[model samples]
Target: MLSSLTPIVCGIASLGLDHVKLLGNTIEQIAWQKAGIFKHNVPAIT
Candidate 1:
């Protein structure tokens, strides 16, 4: 038998105002951009 497991990972310690501004200056926009790094249907604990 074979089994698979996915481990939780953390990236970008923090997203500063400058970074958010570069991404369009809104929390929602920044979140959308950062969310691009993860796979679809996977649980995220932000």
Candidate 2:
């Protein structure tokens, strides 16, 4: 359902925003968090 999808979308967006905010302090952590946000088999640059 659309309601169920909302949390998934919000989680992905949160990971991305958190990754950016953490970049200045920790590059490795950002990499891990970013990987969590991305989908496998899909090409992305971030």
Best-matching candidate per lDDT? 1
TM-score of each: 0.45, 0.34
Q: List per-prediction Cα lDDT, in the order shown.
A: 0.61, 0.49
| TM value for model 1 | 0.45
Q: Which pairs of residues collide in model 2?
A: none
**Predicted structure 2, TM vs. truth:** 0.34
lDDT of 1 by residue, 1-46 (tens): 3236553553543555567656868777777787676755555555
lDDT of 2 by residue, 1-46 (tens): 4364333332323333345655534666665655675555445553
Clashing pairs in 1: none
Give the clash total for candidate 2.
Answer: 0
> Least lDDT summed over 10 consecutive residues: which range in candidate 2?
7-16
Candidate 1 lowest-lDDT run of ten: 1-10
